[model samples]
Target: MMNIKVAPPYAEDKVLEIIDAFGHSGKTYWKKRNTIKVFEVGNDKWNVKSFQVPHLINRFAYKYVRKSKARRSFEHAEILLGKGILTPKPIGYVEYSQPIGLTNSFYISQNLSYDFDFGDVIDKEFPDRENILNQFTEFTYQLHENDIHHFDHSKGNTLMNKKSSGQYDFYLIDLNRMKFEEMTYEKRIDNFNRLSLTADMIEIVGKKYASLIGQDEAKVIDDIKKSCEKFKEFARRKGRWKKRIGL
Candidate 1:
């Protein structure tokens, strides 16, 4: 928001053949955890996005996950899509192997134009903010209903695309830290609020979510609100208390 992004080197050469029709390419960001490169293509006109695969990151992520997880995260998108959740479609993914000294990956998806982070928009207003909020709510709900724990739910990872003539679309990025699982109501609800929205944003968005899904009069919504606080508090403590063993 405060600072606009710049393009990565070789952006022109890497311009996705399909997306070239949109316009020029520019602005690339290293998505958190080295999961992928989020590129801002084109200019002020109709800027698009190019997801350049998750190459490298060393942590609990890189060593532990097998190719199966990558497949799951991508296939997982289909589940969300089926539930009416809006996210960038995973067209394909590249891989790395021992035979090759170096490995790289690229995930191709059409950029959701008009998309920006909530942190970026806090200082500005986008039309259909309510719709954006509602869609976001459903997205979180879907993740929880299915027990997909997004290890990092920060506002930065949660992006909103506001179209001038239509409703906004919500996308969840940074899959490396996600904890996909089947869990109880409390854990699922708590997982949804672990890192993203602030207290107020969560309350407002959570309420909007309840309204969109059902009546908030029932305590389910209130329970979710409380769980959000609890989860965040736990994640905060867990992060601070970790020890660097055998590092």
Candidate 2:
């Protein structure tokens, strides 16, 4: 079975053209973890993410018990927009299934050309670094206030654009891994675990977030730092295990 769902405001014909060209080739944006291709159709740009095929158990689960990643991504984008959170406009999604299970899937969305991501700030010095970090912290606060737990709220998942109005606009990508539930204070702080690389960055975000939430800044910083360190250690251990198993 194959399914395609497009946003109502977009022209269906143009969307069909992009969908047709997705299986072929275009300008590649991401090809390492998953494959993302950019296509120019008419005057607009579209991004089609061809999700890597899942493992056998996951394939069956996605086919039977859960929605495909592409479908989840499309729906999550709509949810974010409804909540006044910025994400790329979802174009559509395509899912292909066979007798065994889901074979392949692709998520389509408008390409957001932004200044840079949080990763850039982590690695290099950006102008107005503290201000940007504060705004990002506020953004995360907003998400937590609304009970939107973005599981993969990592560095590169967020795109920042300095608007002409002299404010930073943020948009989140990679939307499939998310949870919508009331979050505890500890869970909220842990959400930042995957975001920063250094203690300074953690301190900046934790302080801003703590101020907004009226928590002790030092306590928030300490909690976030410990969570980040634990996550990093787990990642390192996982990497070693993967290597040992020849994964």
Candidate 3:
């Protein structure tokens, strides 16, 4: 069976037709763990991300227990929009499943063209690196204030567009892995661990976030550095385990 959910303003029939044609002629964005494609409908562009097929256990879980990734992405985008958080406009999602479990799923959202992502800023020296970093720090602080916890808060998930020299607007992607709840100081600082590749970047963000939150910059820097180390160790171990299991 197939299940679909669409935005109120959009016609489900047209959206489904576009999604159907997506299999034939959409522009391929990237293909790794998942296949992402971009489709044009009139003057607007939409992104449709087709998730990797789940393993046996996951298939059953997604079918019966937990929500499918595509569904979660659609719901999370709606939540972000309601909270005034910046994210892509969720167009819809579709899930295809068999009697025993889910086989495939697709998440649709408006395609956002941006100037750069946080990853680019980290790897390359931008025109106004420090100022942009400071503004980005403010943006993260705003997320925390609103109780938005993004699990994969890594550099690649954040898209940055500069409205002016000192002004920037940030939009988040990969919305399925998120939590909405009150956060402690430690949890907030730890959120920065996945964001920066260099210790210098972490320190810069920590100092700026600390200044905004009325915390000591030294302590914030130390805590974030430690968190970064812990996260790295955990990821390394996970990678090794995956290799050992031939996954």
Candidate 4:
């Protein structure tokens, strides 16, 4: 596995502590994790989100040497941007080492103009569902083709920018658990199986997505199932990326 590290900007900034410590009841901490705190600063010149660090989902023994979960999340965010994937661009981050510095870091990115998780639309009754399924099928195929596991693939973690016309533009969020290195068959199955539990419901979601993207269903169902497992084979992952890149 490649030694993952947070890119520049974050690596350079001296992590700032829970801020607005100087402003009006300006100090607000997150209730969920209770680790992060936020505040509006300088007439909202920019918003800051701060919090304690978290651990990697699978790798904890390397607590000291390996990158923290925060770093992985930020790294995937940055990597997706580099790959020209549709997502928010980072502004900067706050990194610190406990005791001496803030070990857990804070990543700040440009707030996407308009975005919502897929979960928001589900169970809301979209007239055309087949299209959504097609879009989702094609998109998931694309992701697997690229050998990206997106370990935390979920409604909340997956986001979208809604057009003023009420159309969706997808984006993935909360991406620390991504599996990007040397994908294996079992690993890929693990990824989809986790999703298969919701496959039927997701299929309905995909149908709507396909309609939204203006695709056909004549061959979509078969295609989706194949694409679902195709990437599991190393040959598929490599060949797909190669074919797409014209290699």
Candidate 5:
């Protein structure tokens, strides 16, 4: 069985044809556990992400209990756009079902032409480093204020494009693992844990975030440091277990 949801101005039949021809057509943009490809339809470009098929338990769960990751990514993109957040324009999602459960799925969106991502900010020394960091901190603050918590808020997930006015516009990607609800102080601070920032970089972010929310800069910086430490320890334990199991 097959299911598809698509936005307007793009015919359903055409989108289905693209999905059917996905294997041999399009340019491979990224490939790993999941694959992303760029396809040209008429004059516009689209990015399609094909999710890996789930494991035994999750296949059942996705079929009977919960939505597939592709669906979540598409829907969450709409929600972000509705809330005035920047994400690529979602085109659609397609899912295929097997006798036992879901086989695989794909999420499609407009291709975003970005200059850089947060990873560049962390690793490079640029003339506008401080300015970019301040703008990024403000963007994250807006996300929190809007009660959006991005679980995978890491360095590579946010794309930044420099505007003609010398400021930057930030766009969030990887939309599936997100929570939309009221945010507490602790939850907000913990949200920064996934960012691979150094001590000095975190200090800059913490200070800027504190200024936005009227919190004490020193206390906020200390809490963010503690949160980062806890995340590091958790990662270490997970790594050890994976190594023991030879994963």
Candidate 6:
């Protein structure tokens, strides 16, 4: 069986046709575990992400107990937009299922034209680096104040574009893993742990965030530093395990 959902202003029939032709046509934008492709219908471009099939246990859970990633991504995008957060416009999601479990799924959205992502800021010598980092801290503060916790709040997930008014606009991507509720102080601080920021960059963000929330800047920076250290250790351990298993 197959399930499909399409948002308004985009005809269901056309979207379905695009989905059906997903693997055969379209330009491959990114490919790894999951694949993202760009498809054009008339003048508009649609970014379609084809989620990797789950393992046996997850397949059953997705079919019977939990929502598929595609569905979650679509729903989360809507919620973010409603809360005045900038994300790509969600188009829809599609899922294919068998008697035992869900087999494949896809999430669709409008392709955003952006200059760079947060990763680029760290890796390259970009103009207005400090200003962009400060603005990003404010953007993240807004997310926390709105009670939105993005689980995968890592580099590359945030796309940045410079506006004509001499300011920057930030857009969030990878909406599948998110939590919407009141955020605790620990959770809020831990959110920055996944970002690959240097010590100086961390200080900039922590100071800005502390000022926004009326917290002690030194304590905030210390806590963020601790969290980043812990995450780094965890990543190192995980990498060692993967290497041990010859993965």
Assess the local accuracy of residue 83 in candidate 6 as a C-alpha lDDT between 0 and 100. 95
Residue 7 of model 6: what lDDT? 85
**Candidate 3: residue pairs that collide:** none
Mind giving the per-residue lDDT tens digits that candidate 4 earns over 1-247? 2122334544332223223241343334344552333444333322334444444432332345566555566777777777656666554554445432333455554444454455654544644344544455456555655677787665555565546543556677666578776555444334443333234644564454345445564344334455455534665688889999998
Decoy 6 TM-score against native: 0.98
Candidates ranked, most accurate by TM-score first: 6, 5, 2, 3, 4, 1
Indicate which candidate wins on lDDT: 6
The numbered model that scores best in TM-score is 6
Instruction: State in Å the error of residue 20, model 3.
Output: 1.7
Give me candidate 4's TM-score against the actual structure: 0.58
**Candidate 3 or 6, higher TM-score?**
6
What are the runs in model 5 whose C-alpha is more than 4 Å off?
A: none
**Residue clash pairs of candidate 1:** 6-27, 7-27, 24-42, 53-106
CA RMSD (A), model 4: 11.2
Residue-wise lDDT of candidate 5 within 52-97, one digit each (tens)? 9999888888888899999999999999999999999999999999
Off by over 4 Å in 6: none
lDDT of 3 by residue, 1-247 (tens): 9999999887889778877887788999999999999998889999999999999999999999999999999999999889888998999999999988999999999999999999888854677887888888998898899999999889999998889557988999998888999978987988888975587787788899889999999998888889999988998999999999999
lDDT of each: 0.52, 0.89, 0.89, 0.50, 0.92, 0.93
Clash pairs (backbone) in predicted model 5: none
**Number of backbone clashes in candidate 5:** 0
Poorest 10 consecutive residues by lDDT, candidate 4:
13-22
Lowest lDDT block of 10, candidate 6:
120-129
